[model samples]
Target: MRTDWLGAEFDGVKLRLWVDGALSQRIVAGSPEQVLQTMLADLPVTDRPLLRSGWPDAALTPVPSAVAVAADQGRMPGLSQAAPADLMRHQPGRIRGFLTTRPDFDGVLCLIGHSTVWAHLSAGEVVSFRSFISAELFSMIRSFDALPAPADPADDGFAQALNHAMSRPAGLAADLAGLRAQVTLGQSDKAQAASRLAGLLIGAELAAARPYWLGQEVVVIGDGQWDAHYLAALASQGLSAAQADGVEMARAGLQDLWQMMQAKG
Candidate 1:
């Protein structure tokens, strides 16, 4: 309710990226957790729980006791019952959680967020419940947006979405040309140029290309420390989890950079 700053509904997804101290003010808004649950409902084939850590070593506050296991677990900003999801990792304000049925919960994959960690749920440890993400540093990761509908495997529209998704790299190539020119012209700071270049790659590779990411999981490689940090922060939240490796990130970014190089030749 209070922490309402930049609220722009873009491309069918409501995005709120904050700046300054407004990060602390309370937000009377919808739950990102719920949007994800509804998204998962449409993805029955996602029969496995994707577990991972969020940033800042976030914590969780599981649902109340005396509440039936089937009862909705109240968590997140709305403090309502989450969609029958179970906690894979539990800290005071954050959790790695999800739900799986139809296959008798076939396997427990490694839950990952900022990074992946192995978990051992003790007997009656009460790991299953509604949960919320709480972090001192990243306390403002309350991003709530809708995951796009799964593209129909048999539909042409699916192919178009993939095309739209793939064109992101092309867009980045175009943007990079202008930015690199600015760098040469001494019209832009090195840091700013780098940031812009990296953002293009991420927008094209991570967010836009997401619809066609092969594994239902995306490995976000960054070219520089800033990009790595960006991916790490997103990973910390329940967004697309990413891994950080200097060499790998360079390859992802440079692959696009090389396209520019080839064009020049």
Candidate 2:
């Protein structure tokens, strides 16, 4: 009955690890395939080691002697490749529904991560969800130019740009062009431009996803600066979100599945 979990997050650039229920290591280099292979090769053999991910592809990555489980499937009692969407329907006692109210918004639960956002809404007898690609947009912004060293989050430029985008989501593309123009004209420093670009892109996502967050309780997950930026954006709009450690949440989720499997015996 010994159960151990290996939870990993692959946020395009970095691969982070959590062993048991705590963070054990981080690998900054190598592609997702390479880093995962190297990390799994180094771990001590365990009969009950399970691997899970916040995103789908990470869980699909092959691991030696470890079973991979999709994020949503990890909450179930048995191993299955059921798509997350297929499990969205409410099942009465099997799948309970609840609402979360943030300071300024009220809706069902929303989990915002580094590259993606998941919002789940459960009515009395039906459930629905939506996903957004926020992180990928930010990454695209970073690829445009190398950001100046030591980008400070405290820069007012970032907040202003975020607010601007949130208020005028339709003008996001034009705003992006404006950032580049500012850099070219020496009107803004590279550091400030980078921060502002991030804010604008994330703000656009927030605007598009207003239905999920407009008046709902939100929980921000994942590691690094991107996650922090998300929380900051929500706060700027008078919305307060609870922060959860992504690593621990993944580990605990896997453990819950293991227990359910054991109880089914």
Candidate 3:
């Protein structure tokens, strides 16, 4: 039964498809609409399968607008009602991922991706939340020639920098400038520089988001070195977070949505 449905994910630059337990991916060189149309044309199916869009505002083109799936339409037992229109427009997939995986969690969910979200949940409903673009900033900084790569999360420099940034987020600019000076003076290596940079950014983010997870049972979901950094940083502050696979959470979210639609029908 699972093989009867095709799962497609487009993140602006790439398109990934899963069918019959097989995976296929390609660079989205042309308009997403064209790419999706082409892919659909080649599929060996007769009837049109159910279509699900992560959100109306996704980078993927040709999706139904927000008005199409009104808040009341996607309600479930625990995750009844979609997120606010603005938040839904930005992080629908991540919110869906969290809802599907930890709907009844009574604490906070820290979803790490290009943009990280810290959402407080109680009785399977979102109470309050905040979003951070720290990861995006980290990526942008790492693109510079001075810091061409990120350091391993285990590096001592990373921990020290994280501590420093969390303790005094206001000093971030000076600290960053100091790193540049150290690098220019040949006082720091690339690995140490990168680690410190990442630590500083993440630490500042954690500092700003302290109220969200200060005394809550936290679960972190993501799949990347940045995610590992988040876990390690949280551990540094005496907080332990359970981890879940982001990919699995997303698939589960979509599955839940499908079941909800079937039930409605």
Q: What is the descending TM-score order?
A: 3, 2, 1
Model 3 scores a TM of 0.80
Q: What does the lDDT read for residue 9 in candidate 3?
A: 53
Where is model 3 more than 4 Å wrong at Cα? 10-15, 25-35, 38-41, 56-91, 94-98, 146-148
Top candidate by TM-score: 3
Q: Per-residue alpha-carbon lDDT of model 3 for 1-265, expressed as tens digits?
A: 3455555554434555556656566777767556766776777754534333332334421112221122233321122233432243323444465666555568877877767878777765466667787877777766763575666788899999999999999999899889888988999987789999989999999999999989899988875657789999999989999887765665555555566556667
Over the stretch 168-195, how does candidate 2's per-residue lDDT look in tens digits? 9999889988989899899988888888
Stronger candidate by lDDT (2 vs 3):
3
Worst 10-residue lDDT window for candidate 2 reads 88-97
What order do you get sorting by lDDT, best first?
A: 3, 2, 1
lDDT string, candidate 1, 106-144, tens digits: 221222222222222222222232221211111121121
The pairs that clash in candidate 2 are: 100-217, 105-215, 105-216, 106-215, 106-216, 107-215, 107-216
Compared with the true structure, model 1 gives a TM-score of 0.24
Using TM-score as the yardstick, the better of models 1 and 3 is 3
